[model samples]
Target: MSARNPGTKLDLQWVSKVRVNTQAVLKRAQQIQGLKTPKKQWQAAWLLKAVTCIDLTTLAGDDTPSNVHRLCLKAVQPIRCDLLKSMDMHNKGVTTAAVCVYPARVPDAVKSLKAANSSLPVASVATGFPAGQTPLETRLQEVRLAVSDGAAEIDIVINRTLAITGQWEALYDEICQFRQACGDAHMKTILAIGELGTFTNVYKASLVAMMAGSDFIKTSTGKETVNATYPVAIVMVRAIRDYYLSTDTSTESLLWLALIKEELGDDWLHPHLFRLEILSSDSLQIYHGTSLSYVSH
Candidate 1:
């Protein structure tokens, strides 16, 4: 389920509104969570990704080198880490800058990061996490601990108690405080796609995250069985695309010195769609402006 494979490509299948309901969201959320103890490998991927980008690390404490654990320990030495380490970041790489984990494991993740490049981002979830049902002070402390432990990025789950209830202003305020707490580190707002449950709601969540002060907006926390599927990601990408198209700045700003090599080619449009977190080759292909060859994953 963790689409961290280099060959992963983006092929989002957008599902319009008129398709999701409160019951559907609640039922699906439960299903994804229950999948943590999957009985099959195929079902494992989606269920696994639903819980972690480093799916293989699920058995971090298991003495035996479980398949998923083996996949994760490779990250101990990124060059030798998971499938993402061997990727060609110079060309066809499809990984987020770093792996995300629980706050308690942030140190291990930090220690596992490329020591030479300490800048590699290590994201951690915070602020009451999935349910977002905790007090503000306690949530902030969780974020503080995560950062102090070396998390380079923070992905705080919004206060769904507020967001889902149409309390946009309250949601905005919480995100604002969370953003401020993040300080220098980048913040990725997790919408917990399971709760959103629909394209329209997903779109609204994306906008809310960005507008409220998210450096990047994410899908589910992976704590849920519903991972960052193509359809889920596309909703955010389109929102990002539409955002930049309506802004004063251009895509050139996201690039290095305006055209690191040649002109914009066919990508002259100013869009935030460029900032995506597609973890699989299948998803990556959807937006492949350039093709790449593979090596051993």
Candidate 2:
């Protein structure tokens, strides 16, 4: 994977001017979802593409090492061998983009993947994940610990209080520190849009994260009452486009846009640039035409 340069110097004036028109965002999202659906082989191809970009996740309080091990196995071979054979994808090096887990479980995930001889990167949620209410020093330490424990990627949640209170500069500085702590590990900054309470705030927070050099700007930690939504995703992706245009760098942006393939093309769907967190097996089944046998950890 190519390295994404960390964003330098927060553009406060530009951030302050960011706005989201609810009606326009909603309309565009609806239109994108209504694009012509790919059928038969095309549908299967797109679903397989979707599977490759998924961050097969298991974020639960009751998670155990055994379950995490099984999750890693599933990540190595997401679809059953029979299904892959039937689709002629059995030996195509198909695998989920990464395995996400809590900071404490990073070692377990790494051990499991190593035992399986799979090199899938383990992504650990850190820095008071899902809430991020802890002190800055503690959060930075959490990031460093996860990286030390064999995590190749650190998913750090931003302080929503900073965004809600319009403390853009403080949020940018804090995230930059967290990025530094990550060292060589990729940093995925989770904005937790559900808690941000407005699309505009989500846009601003997305900009702040990218400016601070987040390798990926994730929509949620999957802990909030509302996780990922279309309107919120639209706002975030637009912010990503804006940042890309302004800097002309190869930064990545992720969204679940299976139907809007024409507009996004194959390049935008790469795991390095975009990721779709599969929240449910049912959604996977709907796309793949077979029941996902593996249970969520």
Candidate 3:
């Protein structure tokens, strides 16, 4: 696994066609066996980690993000600390995953695990998440505070009006400011695709975000109709694949220069760790939400 093994070549001849039929790509993934298991979870993790350049977090309900933040860390702690202990113990540089929080709970989320030595990535949403209508200034302030609170990742929504009206310039500037506010924090721009009302808009907005400097172009806040669908995700992933192809991979390039840092410790993500925060049953709930039956330890 040398970094310079001339990485696998990605053919981009069908980027648009792939984007057009991303639903099919997801269908192909679903056909794979045991996609719900820990071993299979790596696919989803890998997409976010490598291609989309983000750390995935699950936001299930209206529960305050701060509480969910603790809940998330605890949910996967077993799988992370115990399961991946071997890999992480060998190298402390890696981390657990994502904190996945609501905007209001970021401060406490950062404070909650300050003493731990693991990389418990803190993420928050602004720009009027869920509804996405707060003033831009407020969103910036939220970004400022979230960063100040030790948030490693920031997920923000696009302004629905500007998006529909095609105010991409304004939209781009907003994100640029957010990128500035985030400073070194990775930014995952959530399109809330369901609200975009069309796959076309979703595709376009995703491009706009990525072109403007979004570390990751995410599908949704997981609270709306289009939340985290395999189809929409593929669309963005496809677009990114296209964007990446035409662009140079030089070290000085914007896309090349920025790399998303792993915020989850190996043990912090799975099992066989010194402490336990997450359990299998609770994690089943994270992947399955209310659709499945799961019990917490």
Candidate 4:
């Protein structure tokens, strides 16, 4: 929701020179792994913070207006009223950051949010989501249509073929096209890191996504065999920090708030700059004082 990235031109030299030390990345991640979760009051506070940053989502082949409408309702009041009241947060306008759905379901989300009188943005996943193998023209049009349908945000999945094949220029050009097609809608580029195959590839892809005007470079589609693991996220946030220092444009941090606080500092913790894309409702079952592992998905 900040200003657009206004991406730089393709700098093959910067992309080519990057090298990630896999062993080093793994060790750093291990340090985070060994840490303990916060105590009750702090845990409650962090969970509430996480609630405000959630991108309440439903991206299923069976998705319909009915389901999307329900999703919007939940986004408006994500937690039980009593729980929030107990925390004295009932007066706060605590809703998820946005409601994400497939492109065709954008209007459904728009209508539902309007009926609820909530101003939360509707985000759509476009550009042949999950597996972005569609033709370039088709993918670009998907983004345009989503924006026209009242989606304030667009989550796009980059073509793995482009990243894996080392087509940095092509990848940059493609994301640039997505950025252009997005118009005023903020763009969150999904790198689909699990399929990219290496920490080095993930780092390079993150840099290229930022360089190509991605407002946020995300970890996975949540449909991958592996989605949002700690090591991959460590590499991605480090890339975001690197991009910020070099270009003065900051892409949002990775999944873990603690990790964001540690690597990017407190500035990146704000909701406008960072987001947590929660595709499943089960992840929000924390009103019962559940373990933190529930959201580790």
Give the top-scoring candidate (TM-score): 4
Task: State candidate 1's TM-score.
Answer: 0.57
Off by over 4 Å in 2: 250-255, 259-264, 279-297
User: Which scores better on TM-score, 3 or 4?
Assistant: 4
Candidate 4 per-residue C-alpha lDDT over 215-266 given as tens digits, one digit per residue, 9 for 90 to 100 = 8888888888777777887888887777766764213122277766776676
* lDDT for each residue of candidate 3 in 1-297, tens digit (9 for 90 to 100): 001111122222322332355456556435432133324555434422321122334454556645654664552342354444644432333344555566667766666656454456777876677677887888889888888877876777877776677676677777777778887776767777778766656766766676666765656555665454444544554555545544545311111111111112221122111111122222210110000001122
lDDT of 3 at 264: 20
RMSD of 4: 6.2
The count of backbone overlaps in candidate 3 is 28
Model 1: residues with Cα > 4 Å off, grouped in runs: 1-73, 76-96, 114-119, 251-297
lDDT of 1 by residue, 1-297 (tens): 111111111112321222334454455434433333324654433222222222122212332323323323443333323433333222332233355566777776666554434344566778877677889999988888888887767768887666566566567667777877877666767788777656667776666566565666667655566655544544555555544343334221112112211222334221111223323222211111111011111
- Clashes (candidate 4): 0
Error of 2 at 217 (Å): 0.5
Better of 2 and 3 by lDDT: 2
Residue 244: error of model 3 in Å? Answer: 0.8
Q: Score candidate 4 by TM-score against the native.
A: 0.92
Among all windows of 10 consecutive residues in model 1, the one with the lowest summed lDDT is 286-295
